[model samples]
Target: MTLDGHCAAEFAGVQAAFEAEFAAGNEVGASLCVMVGDDVVVDLWGGVADEATRRPWVRDTVATTYSVTKTMTALAILVLADRGRLDVDQPVARYWPEFGRAGKDEVTIAQVLDHTSGVSGWQQPMTVDDLYRQPDAAAALADQVPWWTPGDGSGYHALTFGTILAEVIARVTGTTLGAFLESEIAGPLGADYRVGMRGGLDRIAPMVPPPPAHVDLASLPADVEPRRTLGNPVFSAAITADPTFLAAELGAVNGQGNARSVARLQSIVTGRGRAGGRAFLSAETVDRIVETRTDGVDRVLGVPVRFGLGWALSSPAMPGVPDGDVCWWTGLGGAVVSCDLGRGITVAYVMNAMAPGLIGAPRPNRYLAAVYESL
Candidate 1:
């Protein structure tokens, strides 16, 4: 299937497999894009945007890419590092003084980026209004204590990551994450990605509901933190249409874009911080971001994860194209973005459907296998 002068062969059997999933009512609307160097060798989409309206998913449609937004936030930080404006090893309090409260003076920027800062969730129940208003949210976080000692272990930081990191960025740069991203990254590359959505809500595709629920947690092992994190009402409610939740400046999550923008931004990671004749970060800075911090069971996620600065390192738990210097992350549902440095490949998949877990669905794994095979 080819659309908009982008040629995409559905691999040996991807088209039939995609059709079968749609026929079985598994996927709603989705888009996948692959970039080798600067060329988009494959760009494909199918299925319906809305079940009731029966509107087909078109090439230009975009949706919230979930945690994949973390990659973008990470890139912004890397850009600062490249320009000698920020230091990853410096105490986060050096930029945001209020964060120094509660014995956080020693917490480095790298610790927060690696999910080891221990400020995983709000201490008290928070309303959507709390999130939309950055000052209130950031103040509350500044006042709260960590769930554990900072840099002791990893917790997913489900909703609080953006607020924490964004506050640091704002304090240091005197600009919101969204504004900086548009002026520095997206605008220069001509990528159609936005941290904060503009006034065009009608054009975006709403996320499809999860598949029919299955597998009660009581039947599983007691130590499964991933299941607990996924099932938490606080975590789910934070993401599912909260009125006060502002999209802009929320760096850890709530990124709105399609596959094209994701691949374009992440190409920096694959290309050693240079893409399309632009240098977003220095090669040394990119290497620093990818340096491994912890490779073990995460205290919050309760799974073996190898984390780099604000990105998941390629490991058995988070597989990528074979034998590549790859780092990646997925949105809440199945949306995925990975930068394969060894192969100079950037792959992105965004969809309207929200899956059940933080990891990806079987469909994405199949797609990835096909992608690797093609190479």
Candidate 2:
């Protein structure tokens, strides 16, 4: 398949890899984009958005980029901090006072952003509706207590990172995370991304399921944190579909967008906090973000994952380009997004096929390697 406007000769192998997945019926539809500095060198997509309906994937067709949304959410907080409206060092209770309940008065905003606040998952059983109802849901998160000592270690937060950060954003900016993202980040950057989607479901590509073999925990090392956090029985059914799932913003998960927007927004980090003539954050903030917080094995992920501010620092658990200063994160399925500060590049891949893994699958690494090779 021809990759539309992309230079096939330069990106032939990358395109062929995606084509094989589509041809083998491993993926229904997907899109990949690579941004080097300000240029979009590769923008390719193909296949069906819906298998039963036979709807083809088009350039504008977007999907839930899943946890890739966390990068954007993290950027939003950094932007706020840059504007002096928020401070990472201050206690979250300083802004959202209700968060002080349950011995969380000392939990700093940085701790929450790094997933070390210990409020990883909801204590109460959540339904799909609970996720969509923002007010009640956000309040519930604020009312909850830490699962362990705040800033003790990383615990993967999974679906609650968005709500936690959103609450902070609301307390400071007086708006929901979805609204804030649209008005400030996406709108300003000219990117097509959203935390809580508004309208346009017809153009959205539903996620495709991964192979059954990939969903099992026994295949991975028992000591890996991804296996522990993602292997739980509760997460298994949640991946298929849960009523309370897509309702609210799960910053750590459930962010919806395409490859274009993912790369566009994350370019702020790669560009040293500036993009599209806008300064979303400062170089100092970016430096702070790359500084390591916790480098040992994550309590929740069970792997040797590193955390820095709201993004995951590159480690063996999650490798990005050759550059060492890059920060990257992945969605539940195959979606992956990375900001390479050393190379001044950003790469994003979004697909409908939901790979049953917590981190990125092999597909993204192949494309990313090609990107750096070109650079």
Candidate 3:
């Protein structure tokens, strides 16, 4: 494999670990980027973008960033909050009046951001096709009742988090999530990332779907958390291959970008609210991102987690990571962007190759381990 891009001498270990993933058949096409303060210490990409076409993963190649899209959505809301447009502490009814229905009148935007609003997934009669229709998805979420009490605890709102937040932004600004991101975040930061595909995308990589689930959903006890969380509508990576799915605004997912774009945008958190030479958030807002909202076994992931406003706090489940104060989130298939506020470093790993589970990806962990070791 011909790895392309450069790494500062101190970050040589990071580059080697990235190449090791490809050598071990763990990564087909991937990119890793690390930025300290304003300096980009490492940027590297390699391998085949599309297995069938034998396309190389070029300098500009981007791939689906599954859940990492949530960070962008969350950042947009934070920007709005900073500009005095919306308040995270206000009830949802303050903006989108209809969202107050179905026993959710008291649910605050902060609760929703922290995954504690309890409208985890759609009500019954859901299908993959429904996910492609933004209007229908938004309406269904507005009318649905919470599976748990508002502001009580968290049940990861795997899909609904985006729709709810997007609706709030739309109700406030009359702008779609993709449009706000372009006008405010991506455009300002010179980051090439998008919440949904528009027009044709060039140099994009196709993803390798994750390995099959460990236990058949049908065979699991009906009351189990994972079964309850993932059984409805069922998620398939194959849906991502559809053009319509790519174009539609899913918000929580369907984001497309690479390691460079993610780090460029998220470096704001590490940079104390500035990236690309502009202030996108206040230092106070950046500090709020680590305020603990929930620390318990995640209903959807079935692992211990510490969720903050829009990201996860470093926890024991994700070992080898530095400091509990660091905040991060991941796309499915091992792609992750982690910002260490104390270290003044932001690291991102993006790829077409997917590891089995969403979290604790061995390859990403190894890359991060190498990064801190270099320091």
219 Cα displacement, candidate 1 (Å): 13
Relative to the true structure, how large is the alpha-carbon lDDT of every model? 0.74, 0.76, 0.85
Against the true structure, candidate 2 reaches a TM-score of 0.89
Taking the tens digit of each residue's C-alpha lDDT, what string does model 3 give over 1-375?
669999999989998888777888988999999999878899999998888788899888888898899988999999999999999999988999988999889999999899989888877667767877766777888887888777776777778888899989989998899999988999978888988786556566878887885768779887655666667667676665567767777788888888999999999988878987899999999999988989998877878888999998898756656775689988778888898988999999899878887678788889989999999
Better of 1 and 2 by lDDT: 2
What TM-score, to 2 decimals, does candidate 3 have?
0.97
Residue 162's lDDT within candidate 2 is: 76
Q: What is the lDDT of candidate 3?
A: 0.85
lDDT against true structure, model 1? 0.74
What's the TM-score of each model vs. the native?
A: 0.89, 0.89, 0.97
Instruction: Estimate, for each residue in 266-368, the C-alpha lDDT of model 1 and write its tens digit.
Output: 8888889899899988888777656888788887666788887878877665554354467888877778888888788888888887777667467677677
Off by over 4 Å in 3: 222-225
Highest-scoring model, lDDT: 3
